[model samples]
Target chain A: MTPNERLSINQATIKYAPLREALRVTADAGITSIGLWRDSVEAASLPEAARLLADSGLRFSSLCRGGFFTVPEGRARRAAMDDNRRAIEETAQLAAAGAAGSAAVLVMVAGGIPQGSKDLAGARAMVQDALGELAADAQAAGVTLALEPLHPMYASDRAVISTLKQALDLASPFSSSVVGVVVDTFHVWWDPELFEQVARAGAEGRIASYQVCDWKTPLAADVLLSRHYPGDGVIDFAAITHAVKAAGYAGDIEVELFNQDIWDTPSADAIARTIEGFEANVALHLGSLSGDARP
Target chain B: MTPNERLSINQATIKYAPLREALRVTADAGITSIGLWRDSVEAASLPEAARLLADSGLRFSSLCRGGFFTVPEGRARRAAMDDNRRAIEETAQLAAAGAAGSAAVLVMVAGGIPQGSKDLAGARAMVQDALGELAADAQAAGVTLALEPLHPMYASDRAVISTLKQALDLASPFSSSVVGVVVDTFHVWWDPELFEQVARAGAEGRIASYQVCDWKTPLAADVLLSRHYPGDGVIDFAAITHAVKAAGYAGDIEVELFNQDIWDTPSADAIARTIEGFEANVALHLGSLSGDARP
Candidate 1:
């Protein structure tokens, strides 16, 4: 009954580490799970990356991304869907397919508004159409497309889906086994409907990943990499974790921070902080704040 | 019939202009309304500022701000409440003291999460409690506390109220005559619940002010000043303006750009661009998009 049983270190938190080296350090620290970007896998060759993850004795929590459907229909859009199909193939290789939490999810970051267009509605329509088209391929491969709704600030440039409710609605058309969403704290902690949405996501069995991180103030120059470790900022982890857990979630808690400061640290030290932050700020408070014992 | 009838140049958009100079140029530029920040009023002396505004024949749209209740109870909180009473008095002097978008609004930016505290709920509760204490004073002065929900990025340090729905809900206990909400495009364009919320605010007779500005991408270093003139960014002004107009709003559409670049421009040239951008991107589209004809 290790407290770190559900812990997973997303490699993005320490991009400075080589893939094999990151895995070695994660294992050395007695970590049991991981989430990886497709770029890392591609850099090492998919076969080698998969072999490395399999040898590390760590659960493959999810793959980084698969959607950028904002491109206008034509060659670019077709290529995106083809790329996602390949991503599904990779998820299948991870061999954690299931209808429940056992499945390894392929995270979908619905791309930003297309170039030279202010048509947010048109961009969103493309995401829905892309999801509907890709859902069958994902189901056929027995892997899930983990729809991720980024913060609204990223709406015009990163993802049109900016709320858990929007993500859930987009996934509603697809089966739970093929489509779900990432409940990433940095993107959704400020949502007024968070508790209710988390409960709904749990009931629908669409909570594919629950990523934790803090939102640092005076956001870094690169807004994308401004996330801090949990407890380092203002998010109330206890309340959110309680809501997610109460909604029947039992899965790995992944730390996927994107801060440049965190990236500069050696992987081992960063891993240590991630573990400490998770256990102290997140894991310790999950069941307690809800006034219910851990399931 | 001038197309810019409802246009009002908020002094923040022309940061380079002195108070009297801004008023004079606004008058010369054929503008009929202006929104004032208390800092500027304090700088010129309230009596002198009021005399200038009254003499210039400009409609005083609203006052800048009055809420910072994130400071916990005791001395600091009492000080915030006292400041708000002073603001209400000034709003009364603005002489736009009636609802239906006629009254001068005492803009309220609910304070950010308190120092060293991750409790967003607690901060929001403080705002509500503080509002309850000040609503009577605002009502007595015939000024509305126009609650302004800032963008979520500012949730930590500017305002906890980040949506019109949340602002309206927070003001629900008070009469709409005393408590209303602002419709600011820059702060709320990413909101999925925007149209519904705008309609609801109008239905409740609580649409106190409508502020227009564009959210530029690659946000400037100072996030507070990243706003652009209308049509300079990706917000669908025609769509939002149509929705607000359809909701029975007929009042000055205040241009409140906060960009350093805009502020650096010569006040007259910047003010000219503000008017042009509003007409092209907002005003011109409003009556046409709504299809009922401008009332």
Candidate 2:
């Protein structure tokens, strides 16, 4: 049962699985690529995780995250920058260890407004400042820091960057290779400027990662975990996938669901469902994968 | 105690109150203006509601709503348009019945994506079409159809228009008086382009209403009811209120809360809290209201 050649299972979609199990199940399911989260990588230790990933023979699509840079200038801020630098190193090493076509991309979630603060613009500026501080390191390590604009619902407590245009504007100061943006459908499908921003991100050559998940209403009590399998929700994947393809994003497209029910499913079954959903809702619009060969 | 002379209590802040009781509580709390919901007005019958509002001697700031225009062309769509027309007539009558400075403004929530349909763009176009069908009637009644862009979380199930810029763009082809946009803080506070759009709305003379409510995360189980009283959450009222004021929206500033807790509070207590929240979080930034006298 071969999954679409471009399909990459984002590990968070099967959250309860550790790094070894996640890689084993993904590869066993005939998936060629996987995106890893920091927790699982740290649990296995970076070197061992890289070895496990190498044995699994799956391309490393991206590291789950790297940024929480909205902290004010202080001990906490210094700590966050240091942590991000470590994440950049992890991304570089894992991408090196994976099969051919691995991508050295580190997804960044600009942390919400600092606690006790209502200055959203200031928090956003801190994200800009963090990017400036880290661009040189990311470029040196050949890791693209992919700034992810989370949905506005999480603006106050999860991420201050809430639109693709805002993410692109923040990514403007650095080189596209060093600073790019993540176009996660769940976070951005509602954006009126989505298609326009997708085109702009494409023109700028900064579409570092394209992640797909579905958004259904009656959002879970924890809105963070409300994403569903593609085709299980109302997202028009045909349009968005075609737009991303038109944007020239040839990297492995990642399916990243955070729903609790999906987590309870056996990793193999989850992978099976993901593959089916991807083929039905997203893969059709991805065009042919022959030209998608990446080193 | 005099509430800010420009403060208006949106009836939804005290959802249980009947139209007559809502007016009584608001006026009894020394609030000089009110924004009425259609359900309560319909409950009292429009003519009787108008009479009660007049007897209360409070200015009518605006009507609570008028649009759910995202339905596909069918009997449902036709019914929605007709309902909106009645809403327009209700606004005209209510404004006339209130004290001087009443605004015949009808707030419009562009309905969610149609059931089982994934065509957001198509649904939005339907909103544009509905406006075209209703604009002349609104103009004929001297009523402003105020387009309210709900937050992106509600984009799929509640409102497809999720940003002030989108609302303004949709309102562009119509006269500002006949078609304007709502600057509701809860719906738009997370927008990165908010200040810019507010200024543009001002320049276009399209800001028909300015409503304020705070947004706290860990949103209610039903996201629609998560609104908080001002100053109780992370919203920066000073920045937003100043932006709205700078944008030339001198109309009544309404406090519209939907939280079950706020709704359960006694009507008089809720109005008192609304007044307190408004004074502390918003009114200070509004400058003196002496020059804001509008008829």
TM-scores for every predicted model? 0.95, 0.97
Error of 1 at B43 (Å): 1.1
State the TM-score of the second chain for every model. Answer: 0.95, 0.96
**Which ten residues in a row are the worst by lDDT in model 1 chain B?**
B95-104
lDDT (C-alpha) at residue B164 in model 2? 95
Runs with alpha carbons beyond 4 Å of true place in candidate 1: A1-3, A96-102, A286-295, B1-3, B96-102, B288-295
- Chain A alone, TM-score for each of the models? 0.94, 0.97
lDDT of each: 0.85, 0.92
What digit string (tens of lDDT, one per residue) describes model 2 on residues B75-164?
998999899999999999999999999999999999999999999999999999999999999999999999999999999988999999
Model 1 interface RMSD over true interface Cα atoms? 3.7
TM-score of chain B of 1: 0.95
DockQ: which candidate is best?
Answer: 2
Reference A-B contact fraction recovered by candidate 1: 0.46
* Model 1: per-residue Cα lDDT at residue B10: 86
Among incorrect, acceptable, medium and high, the docking class of model 2 is medium
Q: Which ranges of candidate 2 are over 4 A from the true structure?
A: A288-295, B288-295
- Lowest lDDT 10-residue stretch of candidate 2 chain B: B286-295
